[model samples]
Target chain A: MNTHIRVAPGDLFGDGVFETIHLRPDGPWLLHEHLARLVRSAAILGLPEPDLSELPAFTGEDIAVPGVDPGSDVPRALRIIYTGGRVHTAVTPIPPAVLRERRDGVRVITADLGVSVRRRPPWSISSAKSLSYAENFAARRWAVRQGADDMIWFATEGYALEAPTASVVWLAGGELCTVPPAEAGILPGITAAHLLSLAPSVGLRAAERMVTLDELVAADAIWLASSLRGLAEVTELDGKPRPHSPWTPRLLTLLGFPATS
Target chain B: MNTHIRVAPGDLFGDGVFETIHLRPDGPWLLHEHLARLVRSAAILGLPEPDLSELPAFTGEDIAVPGVDPGSDVPRALRIIYTGGRVHTAVTPIPPAVLRERRDGVRVITADLGVSVRRRPPWSISSAKSLSYAENFAARRWAVRQGADDMIWFATEGYALEAPTASVVWLAGGELCTVPPAEAGILPGITAAHLLSLAPSVGLRAAERMVTLDELVAADAIWLASSLRGLAEVTELDGKPRPHSPWTPRLLTLLGFPATS
Candidate 1:
């Protein structure tokens, strides 16, 4: 499953878009939402509209794995990539760090991304799920080196934008809130958006708002939400440790994930 | 040759670095300088130091073409790519647009990159010549779509930076200058830096300083410098047609480029 795929040499220059979806025995989670975002990302990059007809076949190959071994909890991640030269799709096991952060929490840091949200250009790709993710990876690496698990980026004006690989979600004043993706010029978080939509079912109001770093630090709880990690709670921020949030397990349940151990 | 090369599927994710060098019948122009930048870029991305013993052999294969045909002026480009899994080297003909711009000059525009240089984060990779170049390509595509050949990015503080794929060079008061790459947080341009190093021989002083957009527009002459396109004069800027400067040909010649036709 960890096999390499062929691509035109030029296609590897990061002039493309991609999407990662959580795969399960039943089907890919939020399949349509992920597909819609993939098309949106492609348009942002001016790449030709991708042909997604082959994706269903690729995802269906191991949909019945759980039936053979009900107790096995294997994690599979499906990636669909669209480049100037071609489209590539693959499924691989989710990495161990992702599962650990989801079950156990993550320590986080804050850093200025050096970008000004109010001065965005017409060609800005920050909102697109672009394949130019080296900066994001490097930011995370820097956080790891600083003895943290992830780093949340902020605009120059002191508002939290998003984490390198996930959307920032928090609880404040009895409401579930996440950063407004459009205003922040970041990728719209599929998991965070869906969770917000379901917040009322759990007796909480949902919101998309700009939260300052101070406000975020003062919030009841914080988590980084993405496709693979669902929500990795911010266990420690800056240098201060926070007690685990009781809502972590309840929200995981609402999202149809097994309760955090 | 325009042939495809196989790569690991993960390699196409743009978590790598690359250098594009101008290939000549005699040798790759600025081979050592390009390699030195390659190492710097790799270190910025945390990739292992690359092995370069094979580059000389790769460049030597077709170095004797002039003896077989004296009138050949085919432009070749050599690419060296180092990814998480492998190193790839290839030689291909230079794109016609590159040659055209070098010969006929270019029309350009300036836009805010939305980055605040004064608040750069510790992990910012803006200086790395990374494979994560979707933003650069997108920026150029945007300029081209707006009826210009390329765009020069400026910082939020109004100082001119570099073009998406090239360095901004200008002449002012008998001195040649480019934006200080380290201070500007940009890829150190091999062509621009080398041209400046050779400025004394051409009776011009070399300097690296921060220049505002107004100052750049008021310069005696302006050009975009890169490996393949040695110097493309700024023929038009912000929709205002600039008269071709006689120095365009002289500077090109100073940079070891043939006189513009």
Candidate 2:
């Protein structure tokens, strides 16, 4: 957590993009996909493509070195930030709230994000994971103030969208599904996409389709997926209690994440 | 620009607030109003209140001294940024583009921001001038790609809001007016406010009104007011040519900015 980084004053305006990877005992998981997305996010922000050649390799031996942490077995969060001027990398312990949400499930609510899926502006950066995250944090804070663990956003048309920092993934009739990112103009969720890709191996079908909030509420299970939390089940949505699905532990194991978080 | 700044990794998330003052040969302009707005922005972002007692004095002698530029007559942009953890100050020359826009008028376009004026969520940060400026910059880029200099945002209801980085002010029938910030849910413009306050001195009536795009188009003159670019006349809007405003120089002079920019 103690590190020194320098950036120009112009960089403070959030004209950048970032990626958060799960640093595991085996090294950073899904490294290639995250890096590729980092490049895509940078382009969406109109930033020059970062030079990946200068980045340190995410090998297990390199990760075991003392500069970041001296051979610590505990997993860490690896963050790569790219402003137009500099590319910065930092590693830190995962927040306790992420672990809590992953283990205990989340009390979820639904809020109208006040956006129309039909009329997104041409310069829309919703599909890019840019660093202008104040609105995202503000949304989460508003959710917490409402006595909820987290909230999901729905468009004006009643179409279910994603969360502040996670993608919505749900199970319905043995099919694993997530909202189509490009069509919905949302950041493509790496973890949710990876989970759906693994669904067939778990004997479940995978698909990307738009779902209304009411239809989503009727699904067997709903989870918020991200790199850090992995998956947090929506145990209670909009004050309605949903019984824990038996598939929670099975899906976590399928994703190579410990069910205990 | 050669100074160094240190910040925590968490500060990169655009969770802070900032103020850009038009530094003058005498001192920073509208110091008290800018500081008050900075505090208001901080509160909207849920950041701790900034302590003004620790801020440096804004005296003419201090400004004339070498800490910034000894005996320099050129105006500088004085920026005060505040994260919950720290307050940072920096001085730098204004961008050449701002000066160019002020001297020469800007070609502006109108776009639907896709945000509903009536449905902004409880945690909406639209009124707060937070550092989450990626979308703002992105919107302006979109305008440039469309062969325009800048863009003005309008609500889905067709009511004009504000520019990406400036306030929309127009003159009609000897009246000076701008969109009401609180009602429109946009950041209040410091320069626009100051100018409107001095409208009586210029033999003009000042008011706040929610104007539609059509109504704005019929106005006698339109200008985008900001700290650095005191007043940039919108000479061309949405491909339609507008006559050069004779009041541009008068308004700029009234605001204490050089008529030549």
Task: Score candidate 2 by DockQ.
Answer: 0.80
Clashing pairs in model 1? none
B-chain TM-score, candidate 1: 0.93
Relative to the unseen true structure, what is the C-alpha lDDT of residue A149 in candidate 2, on a scale of 0 to 100?
Answer: 88
| Fnat of candidate 2 | 0.77
- Please give, for residues B1-261, the per-residue lDDT of candidate 2 as tens digits: 234577777788888899999988768999888999999999998888998787778666544323555566666788888878667777777788999999998999999999999989889999998999999999999899999999999999999999999999999999999999999999999999999999999899999999999899999999999999999999999999999888999999999989896
Off by over 4 Å in 1: A58-73, B54-56, B62-72
lDDT tens string, model 1, B1-261?
224667666787788899998876668889888889888888888888888765446445543322334245677788888885556776666789998999999999999999877878899888888999999999999999999999999999999999999999999999999999989898899999999999999799999999998898889899999999999999999998888888788888887777753
Chain A only: give the TM-score of model 2. Answer: 0.95
Interface RMSD of each: 1.1, 1.0
- Give the residue spans of candidate 2 off by over 4 A: A64-69, B60-69
A107-145 in candidate 1: lDDT tens per residue? Answer: 999988988889888999999999888898889999999
